[model samples]
Target: MPPSSSTTSARSSRRPRRRRPQGKPQQQPKRSLFDEVGVTAVDPAPFADLGLPARLVRALADNGMVEAFPIQAATIPDALTGRDVLGRGQTGSGKTLAFGLPLLAMQQGSARPLHPRSLVLVPTRELATQVTDSLKPLAKALGLYVREVVGGTSFNRQVDTLRRGVDVLVATPGRLADHVRQGTCVLSEVERTALDEADQMADMGFLPQVRELLDLVPADGQRLLFSATLDGDVDKLVDRYMTDPVVHSLAPPAASVDSMEHHQFLVSATDKQDVLARIAAREGRTIMFVRTKHHADRMAKKLRAAGVPAGALHGGKAQNARTRILDEFRSGATTTLVATNVAARGIHVDDVSLVVHVEPPADPKDYLHRAGRTARAGATGTVVTLVTDDQREAFRTMAAQAGVKAKTTAVRPEDAELARVTGAREPSGVSLVAPKQRETPRGRGANPRSAKRPDEPTRRRRPSERGHDDGRRGQASSGRGARRGNRGGARQA
Candidate 1:
């Protein structure tokens, strides 16, 4: 006979509630920040079908962008529907348009002075400028104004632009922080915020400033983060900020473009420079990455002396000088660019057929970014790293970590294989005169003291005298103490 109901209840109660198997309470596996639904491969979609404004579609067509890239097609739909999106694509995957189209489409009305309706935060000034340029035409089609705020440019000009009003503001984390601190800009009205190259921003120690800026936006504002990789601090950002974002990944974490080729050319230290100069004299645009600014400048001089139209780009050059050099490169006036890591991320030029690493980068990410300079937009390109006996092991390890299995070769300055692989050719023996620099003066009075005399010929400085030249000199002014402080804060921010 079954126990009476009351008796059963009393017995169940008397049995000490089954203890929850104590000791740390069986920690549930952590949930991922993204609830990732399967994103199947999507074919290119026409701009009109993506729910974009008719004017925007026309503008895209005018720009010769009739169909969307894979990344653009996948993200634009969800982004237009007002959902947070996490996009991962290799460099040169047309990510700019993916987030940009939706950002412009969501604007309802005019923005107030100093308060933009949309914001795009990038890692560097070059990227900020590029993003602004990319969106300006589209923004105009939608009757929106896009402004760029970054360091190495006029702070007062940025403030004035904000005062007039802006619809979209593209900026680096530091400069944007400086603007917010100076009361020249406000973020409370930002309805959409996109972080391009989010992983690089995190790597550059801008995560704190990025977080601070993001916090100022309303908690409910839509966030769209596009990154080449989604590990480490990037994961932290997604967990803290994104709300069940739809994740779309078009490539693996490390960038591996199908049209890109990687080669490791082993050479002796004595022959490395010769091999590099030969590669620099290649027929098409080539970007050679060096380890230091001094090295970049010196290498450019050496190449110029060899009759290679090479320009140096690094943090050591003034902003105007950097811009001028990059412009020359883009216009085909300069055939080669010898740059430090500064140009690895934002220097996007068409027909860059070759990328050479004069020295191995600090790590795998740098290697990938440096290589990404070429093989852009589905174009075929080659990446060759000049490795000596000492660097082979390190480079091999980095390659393994970066998911690359490059073809190894033993080559000398005169090897036919080198010519076949890299288009190595002898440079003309005519030394080209370094162009005169007329940089935009950073402050008042034109810095007469720092100007070179017209009669004086340019001379290369000794490495010992360089002493870590990072392009900071001649930036401060006698009358602009506040400006100086702001600039300093940006550099350190």
Candidate 2:
């Protein structure tokens, strides 16, 4: 079934080495690989010095960002000059303002409801919402309206908002693609575009759709791309779309990883669940990560039953429900948020003191993102990964790949080290007063096929067996159909 060695060699030999045309003239190499390189944080740099409009500086001050973070200080200057920029910064390195200010400043012209002048594309609905929220104050200071265009909410509401006009549009790629497909969003008028979390976008397999959306925008428009890393995939986007981008990296890709404290807890298989319950029930808002949505849900439910104000978040939640859960977490209404990897870049709330991995991630990058959520913007935090005996070797390999030398501990629920590392407390016996209602993500999937063997075909229904259809418009229903229609109407009433 496999090709012989000789045949493989013959195929390789037959393929000629590709060469340039003999008569073609050699062109000058790119003058600079990038217009700018490695600008570190300019700490204590006031926003006033970044050449931001006075009103924006005032808005920043009112929002308590009187001083710009290092990444923003390094990039705001280049971005404001209308130079195409490629930026990578540590997690919570003030990346949003790095590009947001420039986008609001350099972008020209007003946006009609259906045609925004500036666009920001993110990979998830939560990020889209947070980005819009972060930029709204500045946009308001500038007397401009910025709107979020994402799925998981009413399409008509977004359409209506676009009709009123959107100066800036923050969106997730998939839903934006759907809007583009439906002819609801027009991008030819766009003068600027910003892509946030470039690495996550690539990791989530959104680059294909991101590329298509980029193609729809004007070719000459200014672009700003930011990520935590600049790898081959991100480099592909730079090569294809960005023109002589001024590259600025505040720190290495794993810059934030080094700032957090890493711990590996080795507990017995029987004690794992109890240890986790104690951690989730700990004081201070904690984020617990699981390997799957079901695990996330089941774990959250267990914690809630144990009296921890916990919530579950995964891609399977309706957009509104996701927003509510995140809102509660941010507002401190819900103290513990348990989720899968969906919240990696999707969450950006402040004051998160702990990140617990109920299960270790399969990749080093995921570990970094999960850890990045805590200890953000210069605050120190702890990252704890629980490993049973069976997962020890696997987790060790994962930590090594993630450049983490975790401090190992063999602990039970009452171990002092566990409390010291995670602020984990004894499980409370009180039940959660009320549980937050959850709505499953929109739409139901088709039923699964029967488990019976293929040789055993499912029984078929005869024409008359088709209930109401047999007496009416032959499988089609209209207003005149009274059987099931009455049932639906009665339910509505």
Candidate 3:
């Protein structure tokens, strides 16, 4: 309605302001980085306040592990509060302690025997051993007993230990499934269960066994799953098994290229053995990786013969032997170890200063894993690849794809650079006896000059029968023979 301007202005000024529409309260823009990465940051301070037993906290402080990795910080509070957690982090990012500490702290003073209160399922026996190693001391400090159940060891012994009772059980799915089938161990007592490296187990095709084992545990029990990548079968396991689990992830894995120093040495096949020997002679501990088990054995033997104290680790060896060799290498009883791809995973040793790829791996993943053995726990290291002419392109391609920048050099046995890089010292006065060469037996129609000569008749032939060209037959053959004769003749002339 058209009205006078003054009347409309007065009415509008007198009218109360229209009420603003109330919309849903805006969520502080979900944190951009974590949301973008599809993960959540775990805060560490809350864990300190969560009623953790004093002894365990003291042990943590004593070990200088006061701070937690992102995974640990995120999962510990929920785990201690009795909530299931699904943690995803890269290898070697301290997942063991993140789960281990809380489980131990919560289960303390519960003297349950012959049945495990907590179960940790890993894919390989080596990883089981490693997990047990990391948790054993902490468990001891908290008055808990931990037992390992893995294959390639005495089953009777493990069963006997289980009969005596354990608070924590670290096992592989296969062996654990066997024990459960035989009714030798009861999963009903398990209050907390962890599947460390779940993706790796699934990748290794142990998902069926892992699923069966999970089925044995109580449905309402706390379940913790940790893995590097959670796609494919691992995701299925999480969806089916874990209930409303808190998900935590750490920083994206370090780029293998920028984190390591790569070196490529150009050496003739003949010089490769000597150069490797020199490199193995380095002062600090060194790990030399080869392609096959046979090559690993042969190369270790050769290095030992060349005055390098070396050992070999491969699948062919007994588990005890493998353990002993690894122990010796880690304790500095031996400074060098020659191994195959079997040692690339589930091997953790300290103070390794160099990683030498006697033969480069076929893929960049293997290369990165092999190199990772050296630079660990935030330590500096060097990685060297011995590249022959045939492998140069492959090495270059792998380096490029892996984003590694390598310095190429021609290496020799006595080169100062080799010694400098490997920390090899000049020998004082000792000399190694070269292996003796075997003599070949003289065959029929062989050299008479070198063999004992038997008496024989000497006959003279006619010039036509002798053939003027010394047994030449065809014209093309004769031309080639004549060129060879001319070369000798020219040399003599």
Candidate 4:
């Protein structure tokens, strides 16, 4: 088909391009980070229907927890199949059993000495204790042993427990690191590990220790990370250690539960304490959050003097003292609990009808956590933040960030608006006697430094007490005091 030069050039230039495929090209469906792998559409169901063993079902039913929460129902099925799970849910969302049940069900054999089959790491010692308490009954029903190793307790006792062999171990990173370094614990045999409150662990600067501990576990072991928020260091942990985790996000990053009500009261500096005392004197269990440990102590003392039964819980207190205070509060011996941020996530008490921010929190996360102390587990509750005129703008910003729409008002201690909002009322004028400490005997085995006089207050703020509640590394001291403060101050799990 020879043609003239001009015609041939035009024909060659216009040669039809290879026909392109019609319609949309074949492509794979994009995957979401939080998709439920190996799981399908579901709803809240009974624990019995979730493939949990009969023993666990019976144990849950005995505790009036026959139904699986949304988080539990979503994560359990995948977790039971030995898949790593990354879960994000709000506080009081029944996350413990979401991971714990699967952790227990997967254990087919008893653990050997110095090695546990499963591990749960928490941020605070109080939380560690609470987790242990919550799981002990269920673990027993499964014929398993759950042991907890936390600071403020006997290390020797923890060692003995490990030597005796434990099926499940709940621990704080700091204390767990100590055990690992001392050869009291070996993680090679651990088949499953869960990091509860992983965000809090990151916030408390325990990620380094957490990473080190995770590295010690077998590379092929299953891991579960549950947190209120999932970002930053938590994401890195998932990427590095987990293999194709099943993600379940039940709540937003800063979830303010539907049952929670927020309010900000504008108070003059002179009347703020009186207003707080009145609100604390209301007819219900209340938790008051202050900025520092000293402030918590002073506020409790002031409330007590105003005839309101109150207890102070802060990182500065000894672990025994902290335990005693929490016990008293839980038993209704003290109606008001004044604390620093240390208790924000550690406490899991029921019927906390009111939470007062005597001092505003450092940020939105702290604010939400402080508010989380109340309105827990679908219970209706109120959160009241007392703010001075100068602090109003800052609080507004924090509230906005925390996804809270708090009703703002200006009122004095005697105003009806104050009463209506916070159930504030006048306190009884009779001063209450402060609880006394038992005196330790001066003997050859006595440790004078560890004992406190009966009537003596926590006198001077030791270097360890300073910045203890901040949940940050100390920039000042580098000796054992600083190390002790870092470990014992915030009561990390």
Best by lDDT: 1
* Per-residue alpha-carbon lDDT of candidate 3 for residues 267-303, written as tens digits (9 for 90 to 100): 8899888788777777889999998779988887777
Candidate 4 has a TM-score of 0.82
Assess the local accuracy of residue 54 in candidate 2 as a C-alpha lDDT between 0 and 100: 89
lDDT tens string, model 1, 413-450? Answer: 88999999889999886998789988664533222222
**CA lDDT, every prediction?**
0.83, 0.79, 0.73, 0.82
Better of 2 and 4 by lDDT: 4
lDDT score at residue 76, model 2, on the 0-100 scale = 86
TM-score, every prediction: 0.84, 0.82, 0.71, 0.82
Worst lDDT run of 10 residues, candidate 3, spans 449-458
Q: Which residue pairs clash in candidate 3?
A: 114-165
Candidate 4 lDDT, 1-493, residue by residue in tens: 7789999899889969888878888797544354434223457888998888888899989988988888899999899988999887778878888888998888888999999999999987788889899899998988899989776566677788999999999988877777888799999999999999888888877888889999999999999988776557877898899998878887775644989888888899998988988898988899999888899898899899999999998766766787888999999999999998778885799899999998767589889888889888889999999899899989888888998898989889899998887788999968998879652222232222222221111134577765572334344235658779888867975
Model 1 poorest ten-residue lDDT run: 449-458
Error of 4 at 10 (Å): 61
